[model samples]
Target: MNYLKPSETLSELFAGLVVVLTVTLAASVLGGGDEAGATTALIGAIGANTAWGIIDASLYVMNATFDRKRQLRFVHVIAASPDEATALDQIRGELDPILESVTKAGDRDQLYRSIYSTLAHGEFPARSGLQRDDIVGAIQMFCIALCATLPAAIPLLLSSHPMQALRISNFLVVGLLFIVGYYWAKYVDVNRWFAGLGLMSLGLILVGVAIALGG
Candidate 1:
């Protein structure tokens, strides 16, 4: 159902890619990319990232639920306000930051009034729970994370030498980081060239840190 924003989906993929890339690089450097070390690194990367994917997916659900609860609370507050002015003030205070980038001040004011009218007169259920769409979305998130590791896996499966496979995987992961950054830039309406290069650099720095810590 595409519950995640483009940025969020990119972030998820980036996280998984960095994780496995770190494991692979750390093992290559620390263990001299030996047969046993390479095998261990592959296994560890898959297992650890799989666990991370599940954990991140669950966290997404929690965050989504929290957002829903927050919206409901805001609605209830607006409904219980003493006057229309007070309700509109509260709504504007809570929503202005998000809408400000895309909407004019007059447009935002009108939208807020419309929202105030609808929410003030509406009925909402008390419980805030996960929905079917939420579950589907979480599953989608997990799958994206898992798929991010496939590029790294292919080199490992095809290359006979551990060092060769690790180098290929490293290149693949770094390229992917840039690709995702490019898309992220386009999504956010920025310069794609700078975004791609900047993200590739940032991702390598982050992976180095993670490897150092985990090593």
Candidate 2:
């Protein structure tokens, strides 16, 4: 099961990388030493980011499942409506955006019937019985986050100078954040350069917060 779209994978990768770098940088600043326990810092960053990614992805899955249930309930309600016109109106209100480009009357009618039938029969026609896509998406998110940890940590693990390693990690993360933002903007039809700057600023803000809180 393919869990993540290509764009989503990139977004998660950069986000996780920024988070790991921010926290590690904050830790280095607070501890104030050239060799401020690089091994412990590396392990801590990896562990913290991995756990956070898993938790975040789990929450997303729960919310998505709840949303799916809500959509099904809405469909069931529409199907139970006494008037066909009213049911069609409800469907239009809920699904018009998705079906806007589908101009064929037969196609629209067929789609409405399919939805009504699926809801009435309690068949919930998802891709998999257990929502495999959602599960896979969560796992993909977790893996992206876990993998991001290594890049930020490798410098800390290898270098004797904590500040230098932190600086390098910060630069790498900042650059990645800009790239992530640029692509995200392009995906959403916005100004790519501005979005890149915005994301980089957001990363800086997060780093500032981490430092202020003594990470």
Candidate 3:
């Protein structure tokens, strides 16, 4: 499955966070019916924005490391001699587990080297390639995060009808979760309903928590 790039994933999260914070801040400035309500909204907005920003920045750094590794691999493959390429392939095979661990940590170098060495050894070389799992994970992250944001922002934006907007946004987010999850499931040949429902549940939980803490 072709999914979001690491940078793209971070960017999506960042943009959504900005939207949420902006709306929340706006609501605070406009003033709610009570001082406690306004203060609570402001605090929640600040906390959510700060937390999301940190997470987004961390993801961006990880993705950057991953891209750097891929770039290095490309360079290695292009420059290595046939014998050197063979040696690299053996080394990469030995380092496969380490590479997987590094990738999980968002450290791409080992994996990049491994993949490039493998590709260089192949009779037919690919100009560019990405693992299906990595792409799928990125897509999942983006969809899940974006879906979780709507319930928070929509309600804040419609001050006159905050509850109504919140409910509508909740439904919208669920529908989006189902669509994205279904597509992802079908792409991977999994059970579409289960995947969609699982993602929808996660979105609901996030929204519910925000609502509870927000009050």
> Mind giving the per-residue lDDT tens digits that candidate 2 earns over 138-157?
88788888888876777777
- Superposed Cα deviation of residue 107, candidate 1 (Å): 3.1
Rank candidates by TM-score, best first: 1, 2, 3
Show model 1 residue runs off by greater than 4 Å: 125-127
TM-score of each: 0.92, 0.79, 0.44
Q: List the pairs of residues colliding in candidate 1.
A: none
Error of 2 at 72 (Å): 2.1
Q: Which is the leading candidate under lDDT?
A: 1
CA lDDT scores, all candidates in order: 0.85, 0.74, 0.53
CA lDDT for candidate 3: 0.53
Clashes of 2: 0
List, residue by residue over 11-61, the lDDT tens digit for candidate 1: 998888888788888877887887787787788778878888899899989
Model 2 alpha-carbon drift over 4 Å, by segment: 5-11, 97-129, 213-215
Candidate 2 TM-score versus the reference: 0.79
Candidate 3 clashing pairs, residues 3+ apart or interchain: none
Where is model 1 poorest over a 10-residue stretch in terms of lDDT?
A: 120-129
